[model samples]
Target: MMAGTHGQLWYLGMMEENKLKTSEGTLEKARNSEEWRCQGLSTQRSCHFMAFPSFEHVITMDSLCFDSWFTPSWLDEEPARNGFAQDGNRCNDHALPPDATAFVTILRNCAKNKDLRKGTKVHDDITKMGLLEKCSDALVTMYAKCGALSKAKELLELHISRNLFSWTALISAYAQQGLGKEAVDCFEKMQRAGLSPDAVTFTSILKAYGSIGAADKGERVHDEVVHQGLLENDVMLGTALVDMYAKCGALAKARQVFQNLSSRNVITWSALITGYAQQGEAVQAYACYEQMQSEGLFPDAKTYACILKACGDMGAKDKGECIHNEISRQGLLANDFVLGTALVDMYAKCGVLVKAQQVFENLPHRDVTSWSALIEGYAQHGQGEQALKTFEQMQGGGLAPNEVTFTSILKACGALGAVAKGKQIHDEIARQGLLGSNFLLDTALVDMYAKCGALAQAQKVLDELLLRDISTWSALIMGYAQQGQCEQAVTCLEQMQQEGLFPDAVIFSSLLNACSHSGRVHDGHLYFTLLSKKYGIKPDLEHYACMVDLFGRSGHIDKAVGVIQGMPFSDNLEVWSILLGACRKWGDVNVGRWAFEHAIQFDRENTAAYLLMADLYAAVGMHNDAKSNQALRMDNEGLKMLEVVV
Candidate 1:
């Protein structure tokens, strides 16, 4: 033997010993020898050497040298002989075995390789080799992982030997692509195919149902899992059931399942806590979180997020800060966008806008939600200009505003009556394609216009809306009434009723006020009667005041006085004054004297009422009586009646 470059021993004398001077050539003699039998350059070694040790040391030095002497050019090339092509030299020894697992392994490897071209080639090779019949599981998994679900389904249907694993693969693929309903349909088909799903299959189906909020289907799946006897030892199944029920607002059932869980993990705690948070059961949510920690279970990011949201909903600012402290102590505050956003929202909702702003400023990364929280906080606090400025800053910070941001700022503008800035926001909303949205955003738009006193613009928006809710109708009706457009207001009210929406208190108020402004006594009376009779809407003080004004302006002094007398609460000085002013206007000395005296009794220092009474006395051609009434009015009310403007 001789040493090679790395000091590895190389056999030197074996070639001469194995060679025989036969009738055939030297090559034929070598091929016929025991040393050369079953030996050749392997394809695997040609591409990349396997780490197997020498297995043919008994072979001659020539064969050993042939194995060792590989060319760099042919290192990744096809195997050849004597610089010539050789047959059967590059065949794989570990070619796929003819079974279900082998083909499944091939498909799995193809998916792991992420090379679709190679995957398809391997698939075609399987088809050509007639392995498709035995390879359905592998093929289904292959097509599923490769994102060819339709092809997988076609192949799955072609085979009569479908299993739970095959069904799970297809369902998981659909779930991965967010086609939750399709995943559910595959589960259904699997059940119809008489395949009993395992825990993984059940979890996948439950997750699909939960994703689309299909609570009933999720419950059905839970029952199916129980019926299959699979829930006895499955922690994952229990947790997933909790999550499914929690997401579907079945909090009571979720809690029942949670309590029945033999063992609980962080995910189980998170599921239940988040369920409570979403239901706005902040007390219960915090209690469960405390229980989770008391049992020596550490809270994770999802747990913190749930509790923080509970704080936001319940306005527990102090508790939210405590949670934030824990989060910071645990060193999880930096990357947790969900928890961070929840903190921002909690502070904002609790009316601690300063803390909310501080938290928002400290976020390492802010999304649309972060900006929205601050915008809403300012708008809610009646800081309209500040809200608008913050919105502009968010845009300057390169975060595009979403619908909530726009609605918040528009509300702020509406509060301030910042007509010019409101118009700019409307323009920007239109430019951003948000003007064409449905009810919520449309309602904000109409409100902005109406509050800014641009009734024509508000009505134009109303005209463009494809659908109108009670809010849209209310916006228009209130808009016209605010502008004192009486006929237009009544028309809107009639149209609202025609659309099958009963008028609420706000709508009725607008209609009554319209009658008061335009002096539509009959229509006002009709609406007032219907308010109590049909709609069971009892009249408030504002409604009665408008009715009194309606009759008073039309010179119905006695009727106005009668209406005031019939009011639930004792009539105030304004009601009696309206009656007295009407009496003076119509030269009714008898009723004017009675109304003036009643007004004086209701309020002695009623300057307007005293002035109206004196005028009434003068109008009845009793100069001395008028002067005496004016002198008494001044002496009693502690002022000169001549100085009263009315």
Candidate 2:
């Protein structure tokens, strides 16, 4: 049972980790994964990279004594007395014990290398030398940096002379592991122990607060930082504060913090920009990017990547192209796959598929995100065949599709009405046991089936979902309405309401459209009324058009005219066109001419107005009876000119 539970946890943890992995992380890991640079009197983990694989194997060295190893000359208390020069280059075969500087220099190397096997050997030597108290801080740092948190905490607790560095190692390690509550608990205990935290410690705790969305505690930390005046000199600390607030969705606080910072660097500005981008505030992000550049601070690759995201979201094609040019000038895209992916995503979103494909083809390498971006762009832009081709290429490249990849491909399938392909994807989703976890995938499946006119399959997918929201229900209801199954659409709406899901404006639009197609004038009006009354949803132009269409198609010419006159705003060309079509149907000569005149006044360019008028004359079979036949022919000539101009 324990083994099975462990397996389950591992599987879930791995999936979550993979889902959250992005372009920004793996870049530095390529350079900093194995190297650690020491810069301070107190020990510090690698600032560039945080993740380290846990080392499990333990090496026993019972035959070796504590004082049996020779160490670096710097660790020697009196190098001259030991016949070693200050900048000594010593032979390795010498027989001096490596344990004299056991507290720092040796453990620093172990932590730097993440060599737990050798670190454990040194641990035994430290214990045997009766120097555990003296060496505990470095030992704890070693364990933490080696990805052995339990051992680090065990060593930390057993030592009576623990310092701020020891506590910080554990806190930072917990933060890196995403154990925010544990990090907070450790921080409180360290404060209780009377060890004041430094800037590094504060940065780690702010990251903890951000990870868990504990903005309240983070604000308190901000107060403490302000009380200490820590932000006066440390740009990194202020950036962390801004990042914390941003991650907590407190954009105002983040902006306030950013504005208040005494010194702003590229990283500081990037932190604020990234915050806005992550919150979907693309305009703000773009504004900040412009401001950042005007300050003469060139953006780093990560900043460029983030700004690309903002451009993609806002569809700022020209700005995106300018940034792309700058990126090319810097030669940043050659080695940076993330930047390349961002470029593809930006162009894809802008509907500039040719350039997007060009950038994609020129990319040095591509990952799941890069491929997924192109696929989603293709899917959304109505290039279903291209999306399908990209998806096949991604598979041929040996990339197993994640939830996002599958969602994009499923949309492509839906757009193409490829139900057989959708079902194959559905079976794959089921076999992977991926059905119950991601709700977007759930909604996409239902939407795909509904779009393909496979209403039964769509409904079954919805029913089997562990959790159903308005979106899933909306997909099914829309499917039924679109397939002309009006009664079923109405039934689904009631069922959704019974499940305590209030209909949104979109659902009402679907309902009204269903009523229109079925010629259910009474039902359509009731829904349109309820749209404002019970639902408090303001019926937009689309809803009004549906109502007009409903009454007009049912030969209720007066009610259709009433709908047009009762509209809260000016009727758009579509509404007038529908009313004109209705007038043609019932041969209401006066109303038809009035509708046409009003429609043409609002929309002289569209040929629908002229077409509807002609249809009305032909429908009444009263070409000679109508005096406007000559005027209609003149309008037809006007339409020919309009078409040429268009």
Candidate 3:
């Protein structure tokens, strides 16, 4: 009987073990079924229920037991289709228990769709079910992704158990929206919370550093990345480092990170190339492109655009044309407006207007950028009439001009001296209400009026500006100077200085030119001294040329010669030519001869100097010398015509 009892006890123990195994297997099967149901729900197009048997009794018994749980038919379903319900009132209003998986799936779907309304509704349901803490990270991510950062922050603060994902989502939202400092602060808070940032988090924060030009912050991040051994293991993170440093103008550091990258890709090369291009380092950009090509990495649309921009910056027409042909060969320009615009800009800046216009016409679709590029090209090349015509065409095509377009066309008007068109533009500017706020447009208006010889209008515009920059004052001063109104120019200069605006080189050049034309020798001397001593401005070649003209025009030939001797620039024909013309005016034969020789020595093909010399000899009754110079002038004119015809 004892033996029989021992057997029964052993059998009972075996039976209990088998029952436990069966229960555990059922739970495992239920969890797998729930995962499958969630995946199916995520992919569904519309809300429709399908019974999932494996999820029956999936929850632990400690929670409210259910015979089965209803997986919401589709997480991404439109609320309108389902007759938007509040607080746990989904599809059938069958109150499902607060399941972490269900809440996570719904919140993630809301985040993916960027539907803040649905996300908030789901959050309300989660709160009603008393599972807010359990679903806090998902809710935070949903809010952050939907661009409700304040709500995300409030939710995070409300929860005592903030996870890494919640913090990362908030930081990413701020970084993506260009709130770099806020993102950095979030990062610090995350570290203080004892959560180590992963690679994705690092990328987001590094981008924040790049956006704000915070190279120092990026460097510190680099240290963290190295400490985490992320650099060698992840190319994307390494590329982010290169891009971040490159954008912050730390090319050396960028290059160092780039070289250390174990694997290089097209994106990595493009980042370095774009950095150099943006900094106007054309040679380095081109060299990087070549190296990338040698490595068998094909150039994409972005890479082509960046290199084309570099070509534009350097005026490398030959290189630009070659790249253009390659782009055409690849059929890249058929649909890429950005690449097409870059091409137009390149040709225009290189003085190849014909090619620029050809590219402009060939563009499949032209946006404001294309039109602006073509207009700016004409304006820059002094073809103001062409620029104005293009502007009219752009308007005819139903494209309204933006501020950039207006600025370019205004420059064209100024160049052509079209006062009526300028006035029309002024009216348009007023209609757009741009005159009161856009300082650049206002300055452009002042420049247009000044260059069109409308001094009063220029002054009126200047006076109307609520905030006047140095360029504004300089424009009016230059207009007065060009009109030989020395007193007005001087008064404007004094007013500008009194307004705490320091004069730059261009302003001084205008003042000196005014003095030269109005024969204010003493005033010119005083201003010249003030330029170096008071303003601490070192005179450039143009300033020195203005001085030479000022001295030579007022019968101070010796002083002009002295100015020329003291000039730092070599091989300048303008100063020597000015002296020669002054000698002709003063009838100084010997000095005229000396000036002519020196001018020709510096610029052998200067026909103006030859003509001046012939006139000088004719004024002094030297017939043979005059006839010889006149012959040389005629010969030079013939050569010019032949070259033009060729």
For model 3, the run of ten residues with the poorest summed lDDT: 5-14
Backbone clash numbers for all candidates listed:
0, 4, 0
Cα lDDT of model 2 by residue, 1-646, tens digit: 1222111111111113212121111111223235222221122232221122311111221111111122212122222333323332232222244554644777876675565665777788788878777788899998888778999988887774357877898899999888999899989888888788999999999989998999999999999999999999999899999999998989999999999999999998998999999999999999999999999999989999999999999999999999999999999997788899999999999999999999999998788999999999999999999999999999999998889989999999999999999999999999989996888999899999999999999999998886889998999999999987899999999998998999998898898899989888899999999999998988898899999999998999899989989999887778877888888788887888888887778766556677667667666776543335356544656655434433
Query: Candidates' TM-scores?
Result: 0.61, 0.76, 0.74
Q: Per-residue CA lDDT of candidate 1, range 396-492, in tens?
A: 9888888899889988988999878888888888998876676788888888888888898888888787778888878778878877788888887
Better of 1 and 3 by lDDT: 3
List pairs with backbone clashes in candidate 1: none
Give the residue spans of candidate 1 off by over 4 A. 1-215, 222-231, 291-296, 418-438, 486-490, 493-646
- Candidates' C-alpha lDDT: 0.74, 0.79, 0.79
For model 1, state the Cα shift of residue 294 in Å. 4.7
- The root-mean-square deviation over C-alpha atoms between each candidate and the true structure, in angstroms, is 15.7, 12.0, 13.1
lDDT for 410 in candidate 1 is 88
Q: Write the per-residue lDDT of candidate 3 for residues 1-646, one digit (tens) a residue.
A: 1222111111111122112121112111222222323222222222222123222212221111111122222322322232332222222223334487887887886676565766787788788888887889999998998788889888876773348888889999999888888889888878887788899899889988998999998999999999989887788898889999999999989999999899989999999999999988889999999999999999898999999999999999999999998999999998688899999999999999999999999998788988999999999999999999999999999999989899999999999999899999999988988886877788889999999999999999998888888988888889999999999999999888888889898999999999989999999988998999999999888888888888888888889888888987783888888889998888777878888889888767777777777777778887676766344444757445433322
- Model 2 regions lying over 4 Å from their true place: 1-107, 113-199, 211-214, 624-630, 633-646
Q: How many backbone clashes can be found in candidate 3?
A: 0
Decide which is better by TM-score, 1 or 3: 3
